[model samples]
Target: MSTSTAAAPVVADERVASKGPVAKLLGRPEIGALVGAIALFVFFAVVAPVFLQPSSIATVLYGASTIGIMAVGVSLLMIGGEFDLSTGVAVISSALTASLFSWYFSTNMWVGVVLALAVSLAIGFVNGWILIKTKLPSFIVTLATFLMLTGLNLGLTRLIGGSVSSPSTSTMDGFASAKAVFASSVNLAGVDVNITVFIWIALVAVASWILLRTRVGNWIFAVGGDANAARAVGVPVVRTKIGLFMGVGFCGWILGMHNLFAFATVQSGEGIGNEFLYIIAAVIGGCLLTGGYGSAVGGAIGAFIFGMANKGIVYAEWNPDWFKFFLGLMLLLATIVNLVVKKRAEAK
Candidate 1:
């Protein structure tokens, strides 16, 4: 007798589920920051009418760009699971290097600029190398670098320049050209917007692309998530970390050039605590302290929020003294919101 066996039923995999658009959007690390930015913008617009003015908007953008430039690198470094406490002083050091070298040697400003770039990259390499070799926490490694650089910035400037600041480089060869590239401004709809703003935008765009679309980006996430696992999977953990630190140095070099060209002098004492601002911006942008998550866009939004709060207080005619309190509150609230959003997304 011929008997036909019943066919087995097809079963869909329970582990895979199709996510809708809303779920996908919420899944982004920057989503909470985006919401916060919108709220902040509205609050400022309502409280300070002048904040909406074109000139005021330009000022806000200028302020944002300054921090945002460094935030680009700082955010990336955070995502790669590391910190660079030396960044603040490193910037001033770069500017000082360019200024002192050019003025002392009576050479072209370009020469000093190139030399400063080398010095900055070397500093990054040293920091990374030490971290890799010693397996010390990046915090300690960079903190040591920070202290050393702070001392060097002051001691060297005093010894070489005979003062706490470098000599004026406005008349040096290539000074004008460099200034035009780094410190010039553009007129947009009757408002002057600093060149650094455009540069910051370019940096954000490039960094976002690198983080989202390249093999290097994959390696970054992999290492940040778990260095040992990443190494086991053939990722270049050492190179990636070193490259990230170098990226921070590159950013420092750019900002340093801007400062020197913009003012024609470098103050050894400047940029002492600005590293915290960069780190705060990255954190507010949704980068976890533990790392392995965050986006360039989120950092940009964080910087924008900072600009608003900084300028908004003045526009509202409030006491500037309260700005710090406001900042701290924002930081705490942002962190909580980010954590909540992350958990909710994961649940989805």
Candidate 2:
């Protein structure tokens, strides 16, 4: 009887397997990003001679690590049907907060790190709370938080250091643990890769597993697909959204830590403009701007593309100023392609 029951299930699975390649591909959103990344690699490899170099590849991956870290979190939050504009500003805010604590109080580096994360989480809670409580769009709520955090980051930095850029000496004197975590790099294939690479990779792996293998992942998709409908079905929509917000905030805090490790001095304005880049990378990697359809790995791949373009252009001796033009073109092309692909998917 058990064998017969198992045989019946196998027959049902065989029926689904016969649905065709398009069905299988549609069932897995990650395939789109993978295909896109491969295509881009082929394009660059064929046309840009420098792109194939080991050094060039290392540069791309290294640059991608920082933004990719945040992209993973934003992708998860986007999948849950929300956005956080304050991400970039929060980076600076956290860094400066950490700097202030370690520099002035002579506190333990880990304590300052904890305090920075807590501050970021508090901001995230406020963002989610205001949105849920007031029935406002998350975009509006987060935009306000973004602007406020930007101001706070600059204002606080100046108040502390009397300038926008905090000096390096202050950081070195105070944060020993921060230095060990953020500044260390591992040598790989003659390339000095930051330790943050492992962190980003780990985050992507964990996020992908959670999304594909866990019950919480199911709830994330359901919430993003339709919050009201999900709530009606007993999904904890509010709690889910709040969790996503906290995830974003935590990502921002990690970014600050990574940046501090990379550059000992904290710059108030360094990360303020990165908000759009994270969104663009996520969108290009297969996350829908409209929400509910994207993978964490896609976001990482998107960051890889950005990093490749940035470093490849410079390595190939192209003008750095052209980066802005390239970014605009990329944004336009990716959006158009995504729309076309989305239409075809919907039509089918």
Candidate 3:
């Protein structure tokens, strides 16, 4: 050759490309939801002047916290690739368990609380166990659970409490203490913010940490991405999935307790369709129907969006009937945006 010297081969590392801050931001699962939340906030601020008031904001946050608390577990379960159609009824079931047991047994309210927890965890365990054994889609498994719990909630409440609602436990031992923990409010800058808001924030922080920092988090993502592949690689697919379901049950328990203490009674039919709301929040938060991609923070944002829309309509004095229509529209739009953002992130 000319100089009998060839330049050493130059190998390009495909994975070494540096992503700018904007690129990184666009890569986040919740970025789309964040943008949507901001736009919604501004839209409401323009149309509904009262929405910006501290009192109204507190109310909005309270509503969001209720949904967001459950969204935490729902988000994680989704990340692990499963669904629980019984979540709505499951919550009422837990509340009913505590109220009925305490009122009937004439025991400390705390006793029923502990028992309710056991029952809740048991329901989740059964759902998981059946799924693992039968290999049925989560939909069928939880739908069966949904129906069973629904019947039991109504039938048992009527059988024991002699009504469609649980008996009032407001006078029971520990009622005051339990209510303080679950339903009380904190005065923040003169606004009475519900205790649930703090609980919701704590849950999101903890869930986010698990998903981003821990081995279990990795297991969740791995199993959700490809259970067969993850299993081949030594991931405990069965355990992860089951744990996720149980996590959902735990969340239902917390919310159920809140409902019980906050109101002292729960309607057997109260939670009938709320499972869809939880699913909608998760989906709007960037979770995939096919699973393996989402965040707790995204779910919180989704819940915030729901809170805004739900109250924004009232503030703006629009027909309340239009809410479902707006909810559907937002869900469709958010899903599309999340998909587009994900595609772009992958391309980059």
lDDT of 1 by residue, 1-348 (tens): 112222325454445465789989888888877888889889989999999999998999988988989999999999999989999999999999999999999999999999999999999999999999999999999999999999999999999999998989899899998899899999998899999999999999999999999999998888888999999989999999999999999999999999999999999999988999899889999988787999988888889888888998999999989988988888888889999999999997
lDDT, candidate 3, residue 89? 96
Report the candidate with higher TM-score, 1 versus 3: 3
Which candidate number maximizes TM-score?
3
Writing each residue's lDDT as its tens digit, candidate 3 over 1-348 gives 322233426453445565789999999998888889999999999999999999999989988888999999999999888888999999999999999999999999999999999999998989999999999999999999999999999999999999999988999999999999888999999999999999999999999999999999999988888899999999999999899989899999999999999999999988989999998899999987777899999999999999999999999999999999999999988988999999999998
lDDT of each: 0.91, 0.80, 0.92
Query: Candidate 3 at 320: error in angstroms?
Result: 1.1
Clashes of 3: 0
Ranking, lDDT, top scorer first: 3, 1, 2
TM-scores of all candidate predictions against the true structure? 0.95, 0.90, 0.95
- Candidate 3 versus the native: TM-score? 0.95
The list of candidate 2 runs beyond 4 A from truth reads 1-9, 12-17, 20-23, 169-176, 345-348
